[model samples]
Target: MDTSAIEALPWCADLSLNSANIWTVQQGRCAIGVVLLVEKSASVALIRKARVEGYEFSDRLALPGGLVRGVCGPSFAPCFEQSIRARAEEEAGLTAEQLSELAIAAPEFAPVSRYTVKCVERFAAVFTVRANIKRPQKLISADKSIQEAFFSPLPPKWEELAPANRLILARAMRDHAGDNVKTAARASVNEALAFCNDAAATVNVPPVPDPWMSPEA
Candidate 1:
């Protein structure tokens, strides 16, 4: 992950949906990916289980996000934000009202993919929210978009998160820190990179399959 890129996240420009501006490449091309940094009771929310097939990240633990398409069903907020919020709702079953209460931070970009991964220009944005949202139950009777939705404290256990999500999680925490957001951000960034390095140094082995999946509708 590029620390410089994380530090210089560009504020999402306000674009009107009425305009025919092409945010994504084309109708069936690469889709922009958006993620959220939702904090509840001093713990950050994390989701596991990717449904895509053959992708390196497929079926692995990851952040709550997906491809952004358009306005999330007639909301007054910017379409970009709505797309992210809708991804959260679709994947984690969060509500629009809950998303509205979130304080979104500047968005960060990354190369990402969807189920089939036809495009590689997917941009990932992180929204930071300091509120009281409960972790969804992890049973089949609960939310569908993820296998499990749980909260983890800061300095998160690096081994538990997917490679990509761990970096963004650190970036979001740093961006949302107190008056010393910069210092906090630097520390978190270092920790994230160090973990990445350590993981790379370790012995390679196939990851165990996780049972979490999108629940039946």
Candidate 2:
């Protein structure tokens, strides 16, 4: 189907689609994971998307993210930063306008938040961005792939979360507890990436690039 986002990824050099409609990433792929937190909450009330039924990890609580494909431009545009920016908007309704810092969704911007996830066929580089939102429940979406979005309290019951989410979130809350939103978000995400190592292992991490690369691109 749409291959623009996959093409923009330098690492997906060996990407193909010979097996019907399924993509083949020989080297690996990039899965964009966003850690959406709300501002001034009593506790770590993290926002999680409830995946829609009939797909992998359906009905499970998870960070809003997906593969790099179809993110930058569902029709034509593509790029690294746009992919992340697009995912943040599409999944969490947090637009680049809302958080100007989110506009810089580039590689190497925060290497600490980057890591790899293993799969049977290949692996995925998990690219993450952490930000705080205002009243997450108000931003919940129903038209997207997810059934809905809601605030899942921090220290969420590990059993209720997606495996990768469990690993990442648990490690984040445990090792990076603090008050500063950005600092805490950074610590938790970076630390979790370092500790869990392969949170998306065995799970199909979707490629979530922006529908459009950018106004300039």
Candidate 3:
């Protein structure tokens, strides 16, 4: 199992959803997540998932997303920005116009980071987008399934997040840390990832399938 995180996944843009949330491409399940980070204060806008039964990452801090849902033809070229914008609007109380205004070009988002959570059998791609929000703390969840939406300090206590998200946040916050702190944080994340990979190797747990699907909101 390859535990190293990469900037892009081969199937990241190959997945898509119809209005009904079924996989339009039938390529299998993979999730895409966004890290809406406020640059000035080093905070990230995250939604707290509602305490729902049978839901992974229940009541945990996570990105604004569920399954990939959008209109796409056989080509399946819906960009990551589509889902990122959709989730930001639906769950984080942002409007399409607002998010659209934030984007200037193709790579409005930060580097992509792909990961897998062995315990949940989840494969996901998480992208970080820098934002400039004056009152980030006032943000609220627009979706009922989410408990609340607020700006969490980057690298928020890892215990408060789900497994894959822990690595995502770690990578995002590492950029804001001092050189010494950055090195330490990176080492910590690599060790954690190594541990997960070794455990998966022993258990023969399928790490990441050829394709991926569904994320949390």
Candidate 4:
């Protein structure tokens, strides 16, 4: 991963990952989330999501994250950092300070814009933790948002994860290849490659033209 590239990114405050910033047809929206990768020994942590009443995909497995609301003055890097840290603590009982001790992956974004769908841009950061120095039991018990949480091998149990999480996890792992957690970095390469291959066959397409304002249109 290019640590320099991450460090040099131009922070944009307008970008967000808050669901509350729902975009209307006349405008676009931006939001952010984080993938909390907690590692110990050779295993990584995963939360078996609890079923939120009347919530869509509430039971789907996902990393610890939430909406990125509010601005962080001139730079949004602090917002991004704080958002993930807060979410990790809220949803998984992991502290931002603890996460800072681990390997952090470069931020990644996936923008989706289809005429038939909502136009929104979502950004995510990966906060990896090598918890050998921390008390795993205390951290685990403090997480109140999950139904069940457990540690699994690196590269994860692909079949056991939600489809979206599989890709997110793989991508974060790939970008964090140089993190302190060498096992996750090394194991994630193959998984990320495989996902990319499958994705290329389906999602690789030419850029969509702006139908509303185009010389050709």
lDDT for each of the candidates?
0.45, 0.43, 0.49, 0.45
Cα lDDT of model 4 by residue, 94-119, tens digit: 76455545434433232111111133
Best candidate per TM-score, number?
3
How far in Å is the alpha carbon of 70 misplaced in model 1? 2.0
- Candidate 3 wrong stretches, greater than 4 Å: 1-35, 72-79, 100-123, 129-137, 179-217
lDDT of 2 by residue, 1-217 (tens): 2334435665445554333222334333433333433333534333344454344455666666554454333322243455555655676566666653332233221111232224223334444444555333445453356665555555454545554454444444543445453343554344344433443333333332221123355
| Model 1 misplaced regions, further than 4 Å | 1-22, 25-30, 72-77, 108-145, 175-217
RMSD of each: 12.0, 10.1, 8.8, 10.2
Write down the worst ten-residue block by lDDT for model 4. 205-214
Candidate 1, residues 81-170, lDDT tens digits: the string is 665566666666666655445544433223223232365322222223323354443312144536676666665655556554666655
Cand. 2 TM to true fold? 0.50
RMSD of 1: 12.0
Which candidate comes out best when scored by lDDT? 3
Candidate 3 lDDT at 69 equals 42
lDDT of 3: 0.49
Ranked by lDDT from best down, the candidates are 3, 1, 4, 2
Model 1 per-residue lDDT at 61: 57
Name the Cα RMSD for model 3.
Answer: 8.8
Arranged by TM-score, best first: 3, 4, 1, 2
In order of appearance, the predictions have TM-scores of 0.52, 0.50, 0.60, 0.54
Q: After superposition, how far is residue 141 of candidate 2 from its true place, in Å?
A: 1.3
Which residue ranges in model 4 land beyond 4 Å of their true spot?
1-27, 53-56, 71-75, 102-104, 108-135, 141-145, 172-217
